[model samples]
Target chain A: MKRAVFKNNWVAALMVAPQLLIIFVFFYWPTSQAMYWAFTLEQPWGGGNTWVGFDNFAAILFDDLYWYSVQVSVVYAIGATVLSVGMALILAVFVDRQLRGFKAYKIGMIWPYAIAAPAVGLAFRFIFNPGAGIMLYLNDAFPGAWDPNGNGTHAMIMVIVAGAWKQIAYNFIFFLAGLQSIPRSLLEAGAMDGARVLRRMRDIQLPLLAPTFFFVLVINITDSFTDSFGIVDTMTGGGPARATNLMVYKIFNDGFQGLDYSGAAAQSIILMFLVVALTVVQFRYIERKVHYT
Target chain B: MIERTPILNIVTHLILLSGLILMIFPMYLVLVAASLDLKDVSAIPPKMFPGDQLWVNMGVAWEKAKFGEKFLNTFIVAFGVVVGKIVLACITAFGIVFFDHRLRMPIFWAVFITLMLPLEVRIVPTYAVAANALQPFQVFMDVTGLTWAINAVTGIEVALEWNLLNSYTGLIMPLVATATGTFLYRQFFLTIPDELVEAAKMDGAGPVRFLREILVPLSVTNIAALATIMFVYSWNQYLWPLLVITDQSYGMVAVELGRLVPKITSTGGEVAKWNIAMAGTLIVMVPPILVVIFMQRWFVRGLINTDK
Candidate 1:
């Protein structure tokens, strides 16, 4: 790892200063303030903040609502990761075999990736609109069958669908790449041994694609936390009786809207810790698998 | 290519086409809704065909929802972020790759830590900082003893209380702390091969000259790639602008699209304008969609390389 060193130190300092400054002022300072507020009792109304260590943590952990949010977030993460990644793997497998018009699918698939989360949520909202949507077509045979707006389970499912729908493109890209990188001779050997397509997938392909699977899983999970804010904010607004209030939504609802600064900051810290741990693992795996195969 | 499985190929086509339908269905619905007026959109099963009101609904969304201003604001914020973050990232990557500075590792890790502490995590404190950007400036002034000197010499004391809230700077500034661009640029720069650097140095090219003459031209594709991704990322931003921009006049199209969602009014007083909401959604998606479509190669390459 030989790096060329610039002779002038001033030039070097000047070069990195802008980005470092942005991060310091925006990223690090706010993070430090969040860390400070996490332990202390910083109420919304009162100006003076009393230092009450661990009380915030205890309160948030003990609260039934917070636990419920945790359960909700976990379910969302797992559901979204599975749906998006599973579907992507399936599509990648089909496309990897060089189906006709696979290039068109490859290009068409990425449109969803570029679509904003809010747009995704909005689009799904109309699709799942209770009265006038295609869902109404289902209710025609059976009166009052489905309504994501009023039903908790339905709302949660819609959020998951919207979240996963946006992510399928991303997961598909990596899976397609990973599947392509597997030596074709291995598949030929599997086929020559009389292994069917499904058998070949399970025995030969899936094992080799583990790294990409793991990578996408972690990414989709972490993305579910931070990225779902848009989908939640738009689709349900964490709503129909707080049905879709994932942990990240709780932070925004409690802190920004509810003005519970201390509690929200505590929630933020908790989410941050989880993501930080995930990101460390993410960085390690990615650095090792630079080509992401 | 490996084995002939006739039934499997047909089944594969069926599944892929089905997946593609799911992907396209929503956009198709949105487009259908956007084209139709209220009555057609509210009709059972909604309108399947494009209506005559596509332009009309867009105009309504633009005029009634003040979408023009929102579009301008979104453009400013997204464009600024792309320009600001990409340039900063390139220089930061250049500094890290080309210099053995003492602070390089610390700076690199600090930027890397931004990856974990995403903007959503510390929204409250970050909002406060955006609302009161002067605190740090004043502290710097005090630490440098400039405040006292200015006060002593000018007989006037100034306390800077400039809030970046609702401004383009407010929108663009905080968001630029992303490490993805830096990481992408750094990875690209690292692949430049030490031989190129050594040869350039032997030819008596200074650091700036070498970077401009060789590295800059070489990294144009990387820069464009990163810019495409960053632009789309910035344009799609929903929460940050929601927090930072409290002023209604500075509304972003993403947030406005959410608002444009006509509420299903209780007591059935007036049906929600599903048409306008769909139109706004279409408008909000168009720029990013166009960008990603036009720069598909670069966009995909940047995303895979950045991997975050």
Candidate 2:
């Protein structure tokens, strides 16, 4: 709230109504409906429903395919977070050295952030196509080496790489900002003390960047869980033996394709809790980060 | 500037160059593939160099994918979302920050809680809601027995439904309902000095006047930044449009690109023509990438400041 403010109730109400109405119709209504369907057995296409407390959850929890989706989702979240964050940190450190044409590198690195994940997926699909590109040479060297379509592990790696490719730009921006925010005097002191570049980064810069690292970690994890839908949908529609059927993709598949309303609703509830928990952790870290700074 | 070791300098440039290459490699492949003809594109080890078929492939992709209409729909949705989000967020933040009403906190929290619940989490139910935009009103009437009373008096049962599916309203409203822009505006508004508001009050400027003459001008950069982000975000939307829009004519570019890649072929085989798909991807990518490169300053500021 501002210290100096207006006191017009009607104007205020009118001003806030549009946003409140929009959120109610879109956010709250749908969220409440999801909770309703999660606890009730409902048919798709506006059919009748019956209340079945916790039965939907029970069925989903017992289903092996649901467990597989959860397993792959965790693997994807972890894999993407690690790959993107690590690559971004490396690139950010190198760029922060103020090498020649650093500005161009920064600009080049950040443009991928603008590219849609689905587009990235499509591009990488071409690059990794077994019949073409680098994969062809590798397959030529060894008769049957790389086929994401036939192999599940290879599919997972492909999606993770594609997912991480876009995120590297995002994490690079933050990591670069974090690196720059560290007082240059600290690095200069380390340099005067004859500490090598890598040693100085490990000792001083990395420690100070813990907050940024944690922030990017939480963001990347949640994003991989939810946002990987695009990449997975474009690249491997959660195919090749249910390998990349991440939770979000599965929800869409089961709800829209399979028409298992209550089951998908229950799964959605579970994923929602996971996201909410991660977000809470993130917000809590942000609060602590404020004081740390 | 910290250390001028020749070995470290060479290594730093080498490492940065490699990172840049890794970043640009996929895009380079897309470029090369988009520029090649079908035969050249599908060759073993693929054509790593650009060919003269760029315009030809783009023309083919454009015609096959119906990108002209798709691009138009995408522009409407993207532009609508940006304008709608900015307007709603601007007014909402203005109300929350400049007023002393009791509903202020409630409304603020209402928007705040939505930050945690992204569209992906409750996608199915959202589709349900969007399919019938007037269901809430119907439910309200039924729960209050208004429908029953009306039926008993007039002998006519009432049911209301406004199908938002396959419409522009359905696409833009849900995407614009997030609180990111509101929070961004609020963060910015708080940084504004109290003295300015006092001066405006002394000048007899009303809340609307103060907002128009004072805050909007000051927040131009912030608005531009948020618009850049929101435009890219909405333009890149895939799942929502895929679910809400059943008609091919209403498809968005991202979803269309996704659709084009899987089963698109002149001969209708399992393998899609990589060249045309790459061309389509490049065409779809041009707008957002250009926005990012041209508005680099605002885009970065929006990303960093919104997170903070």
The candidate that achieves the highest DockQ relative to the unseen native structure: 2
Candidate 1 residue lDDT tens string, B178-210: 798889989888888788888999999888898
lDDT of 2 by residue, A1-293 (tens): 33888978799889999999999999998998999999998655666788999999999999999999999999999999999999999999889988889899999899988888889988888888887777888898897889888799998999889998889999999999989999999898998998988899899999888888899999999899889888888888897788888999999999999988888999999999999999999988888878877
lDDT of 2 at A125: 83
Best by lDDT: 2
Give all candidates' CA lDDT scores. Answer: 0.84, 0.90
lDDT of 2 by residue, B1-308 (tens): 86667998898889998999998888988999999988887777657789999999999999999999999999999999999989999999999998997777888999999988789989999999998988988998999999999999999899899899999999999998989999889999999999999999999999999999999999999999999999899989998999999998999999988876663112355667888999999999999999999999888978888876
Q: Chain B, candidate 2: TM?
A: 0.95
- Backbone clash total for model 2 is 0
How large is the interface RMSD of each prediction? 1.9, 1.9
DockQ measured for candidate 1: 0.66
Model 2 lDDT on a 0 to 1 scale? 0.90
